[model samples]
Target: MSRPRSYDEPSVLSGAMQAFRRDGYRGVSIRDLEDATGLKAGSIYNSFGDKAGLFDAAFEHYNKVVLGGRVDRFAPAAAGISGLRDLFISLMHEPNGESHGCLITNSAIELDRDEQTYRHVCTGMDILFEVFLNRLAAAQQDGSLRAGTDPVLAATKLLALYQGLLVLVRAGRDTQALERLVAAEFHELETYHDARPAQQDIQA
Candidate 1:
């Protein structure tokens, strides 16, 4: 039987993800990965067939773990619009207040349309879109969403806004301005209800 691996898979992937996020796939070298992952070249090669394989594994980890964790922490189904606003706000406060940048956004900008990483980028985007869509739909069902706002359209706009905010954040744009913009957008979502008369008022 083959010998069992000694290294922690999640730790390795997390390190590789940080490397990839800090520097795009083309910018990161094997030596860089070795330093980031704490694995010798031979062990890296043995555990992952090649650099591409390691990157793929790391990208998947980013989608499943890091991104998923953020969604779970900030925007669960029950949380609704407040959750989404919190999610948007959280982007401005990444670990150490440093913008390593999102792997999906970085990959989409760095990789070509025909590249394999393109599919991974799409997958990550789809995850966020689905979360936005589902959350909006739930909010609408519960009467929290604005009057006559289509959940599908709102979710699409949210997905776009979310990606754009990440791009701006990575560029070191004024985060306070971005936070204010997010607040304005979410404010619009709830303003209609504020203007509407309550049930007792309607009856009176």
Candidate 2:
């Protein structure tokens, strides 16, 4: 039997998530985790089993709290295409101007071909994709999306654009340029959107 943890789990996981976001899985050391989580090496090992275990937990935390929260805040189901545009815009303006890069994007690049690491990356990516798909579907039903637009394809494109933008941000690309790109892409979607309702009216 193992001893119960006395420390705050969410707090510790948040710290670890930040560390992992700033530094890739291999880049973060045991000592670094100690500094980040405020837990001694023995305590960490005893609680999490190893660095990989802690990283896994941290990754899950990021997906659940950070990514999920952002989606809920910016691009909820009812927000539709406008909400998705805001979601993309929000990515450019990181809090406090911080740009540690997205965890899922960074992990996908750094841990490519590693099935174990890709599992978490895939989960995070799927979350975004699903959000895009569901939101677009809602937009279509509400006659906000262009008639005949395929939600799945649009969602996939948005997912790719999202990941690409994150890479550009991490590479120190200009924020204005990225924002403009997001605006232009969403503009096309909006362009068709305006015609959608009129088209529906004509059909009716």
Candidate 3:
């Protein structure tokens, strides 16, 4: 049999993911991976094949561990719209220093020419949009959102707002300003749904 594996696969992959997240795939060198993972060149080559292979594994790890958790926050709830609102608010409230914007967004910027990488990033984005769409549809069906509000359009707009917030956060905006912008976006969403209660209805 071949030599037994000596390294901690999960921990090494986790380190590789963070390194790739902080520096784009193109920027991360074999040396970087080796240094971050504590895996020598030979071990990395034998276990992961090459830089592209390591990146593919690392990207998947990042998606599952980092990005995947965020999209799940939009799960259907008593107040679907409110759930979506809270998800966005939490995202914007995340300490600015802790965010690297978004891993997929960063990958899109750096790996525009690589079809495989581009497709992977697009697929992740599609999943996020679909999650928002489901929440918006539930809100519409429950009458919490106004009739005639297209779920697809509303979802798209919400996703755009989220992506824009990521960009703003990456640009070094303060948390207070991000919170204000997030609140404004929520107000805009309510206005779009024409969701104001009448004065008479409130009194009753």
Top TM-score hit = 1
List model 1 lDDT by residue over 37-92, tens digit each: 99998999998999989999999999999999999999998898999999999989
Best by lDDT: 1
RMSD of 1: 5.1
List candidate 3 stretches off by more than 4 Å. Answer: 73-79, 190-204
Let me know the TM-score candidate 3 reaches against the reference structure. Answer: 0.82
lDDT of 3 at 59: 76
Ranking by lDDT: 1, 2, 3
Indicate whether candidate 1 or candidate 3 has the larger TM-score.
1
Q: What local distance difference test score does each model get?
A: 0.90, 0.88, 0.76
lDDT of 2 by residue, 21-70 (tens): 98888889999999999999999998889888888898999999999898
What is the full ranking by TM-score, best candidate first?
1, 2, 3
**How well does candidate 1 match the true structure in TM-score terms?**
0.91
RMSD of 3: 4.6
Tens digit of lDDT per residue, candidate 3, span 1-204? 988898898899988887887777878888998899999988999988888788878777767766666655544455477767777777666564666556777887788656665666887788779878887777777666656778899889887887887777777778678888777766665545555789999899
